[model samples]
Target: MGVLSGVKIIEMVGLGPGPFCGMLLADLGADVIAVERPAADAGNPRPWELCSRGKRSMVLDVKKPGAVETFLELIDGADALIEGMRPGVMERLGLGPEVCLARRPSLVYGRMTGWGQYGPLSQVAGHDANYVAVSGALWLATQSGQQPDAPPGLLGDVAGGALYLAIGLLAGILRARQDGQGQVVDAAMVDGSAHLLNFAISFLPDHYGGSFEKARPAALGMHWDRPYLCADGEWIVIQAVEPKFYAELIRRLGLDQDERFVNEQRNPAAWATLGDELSVLFKTKSRAEWTRLLEGTDTCFAPVLAPEEAAAHPHNIARDIYKTIDGVLQTAPAPRFSVTPSAELVSVPPRGAHTKDVLAELQINSKRTGDRGQATAVGSPG
Candidate 1:
């Protein structure tokens, strides 16, 4: 049993963050039942997909006559419920928050959407990048000359959308456990993405003129605190932006006596030239060579690694940051506890693979036993 063992969460399946939140809960030991549509395809079954690991799945064709009853039955004892749909879609299916809450009064109702339940753009069809774009997040990432590149949409979908919704759902569960009451968690992808821009937004003047033309306080800007390419073509990130750490970085680079680089209080003018020089200097050494020289220093340097590289890194391997289950590698449960740490990965089920078993546990059996589950999911991926 894991830390969230026995906790029940029903995820009304959708793309991106919805699956991700369900995966997080399942990883932490919740009985996450992904209520997928029978017609929905559950993407690839690769364990490295990261967000799709650690979930049990069921397929219910809600358009069928008795599917709504089945949904109500599944939610009777659920502790939390999450759905990512436009405003009225769930209501049309008779599985909206109000109906589910009426069935299970203590259910933590979580709604994930691009805009929100009610907003000017609530019904607009958009994805992660579009959601983050209107929130001023994409603007902050633009370089001095280049166009603002898409940030791969991770912030709004996974980090902002999924992670925040997971946290909120867990928090709501704790509160419901204490107060014998439940509440709604309005987790909007745009809202979460906007909240992530707190640092940048704070620097902006509310009135006017303090637009994107402004730099990021020099101390926090990407000019001096970004990735530089190494001789091996891999990137090493350096972020010693504080004065003391800057001094340390200068000393490590053997530039302590350079008059222009020494004046920490007024060095913004030289940032352009210094950044160019450091770029050339960094490219002179491979990532491995620099690791030996800067490992324990205050330079705040680290080599950027790809997913496969990260899984096999010495530090990650030493920390047991990832685990293998059924020959497929995946990240371990996180935010660890000393006394009640979470369980490691057991196995990742294929889509709709647990339909019969879960339905049997729910006492909704159609009396067929052996191989019935596999038979039902014959065309589904596992």
Candidate 2:
């Protein structure tokens, strides 16, 4: 059993962050019931969809008769309902928070969206980049001010949207447990992405060397905190922020002979020159050579590894951070506990994979268009 073993969630199937939030809850052992559309790929569902991992699936096409009531029946037993629909889509379908909260007084209604429930742009369509751009987080992508770029959806979708929504649902659950009244949690990606800039915003004055114009380069270099290309074209990064760590870095690189670096480590004026010097110096050795020299020391150093490389790294292997299950390479469930630990790798259920079992467990008779008459599971529970 996990820490959240008794918690139950109704996950309305949608794109991106909604399913991700469900996966996180499921990883912590929530009894997540995914309400999906009719299985178009009923016979050939992908079992490796990581975002839907560790969840039971039940098909609920609301256009069909009595489906909405069936959905409400699931909500009655659930502690939370998470959906990544637009602002008013749930209400249009007659399954809004107001309706759900009436049926289940303590149900946490989590609404995930890029622009949130209100404001002018709430109804407007947007993806990760747009939300990050509007939220000022895209500016932090200052790779020396060369057009900010990041891995797609990592910032806005997963980090900002899904993560914040998960926290909001958890908080709302606690609140409902205290007072039998639930509320809507509007987790906006734009708001959460802006909140993510707190570290940069709070430290801007102390870090930018008293010059706002220097912030870009400061972000790029950040007191010797940057990636360097090695002789073999692979990369290694370092962030020796403190003077003593800087001492250790250069000492390892045999650059202790230089007074310009030794005496003037913290001066903002010297960073540009130091970065340039290191750029030249790092190219002289292979990334493997540098990793051997700097892997375990306190220089805050690491190689720029790809996902496959990261999964195989010694440290990651030692911690069991990544696992390959059913030919799928994915990270293990995280934030482990000493008392009630999270589960290991959880399998992704096929669409409507648990329909019969879940309905039987809830004691709700379900109807559908299928020849099976009763709500037979669409496919094997792969």
User: Candidate 2 — which residues are off by over 4 angstroms?
Assistant: 41-48, 209-213, 217-223, 368-382
Candidate 2 global lDDT: 0.80
What's the residue-level lDDT of 17 in candidate 2?
A: 87
lDDT of 1 at 156: 82
TM-score, prediction 1? 0.86
Candidate 2 lDDT, 313-342, residue by residue in tens? 999999999998888898888788899988
Which lDDT tens digits does candidate 1 get at residues 167-281?
Answer: 8999999999999788889888888888887767566785123665564233334345878889999888887767788788888888889876777423556677778888899
Error of 2 at 158 (Å): 1.0
Q: Which 10-residue span in candidate 1 carries the lowest summed lDDT?
A: 373-382
**Model 2, position 287: C-alpha lDDT score:** 96
Instruction: Tell me the lDDT of model 1 at 367.
Output: 33
My TM-score estimates for the predictions, one after another, are 0.86, 0.93
User: How many residue pairs collide in each prediction?
Assistant: 1, 0
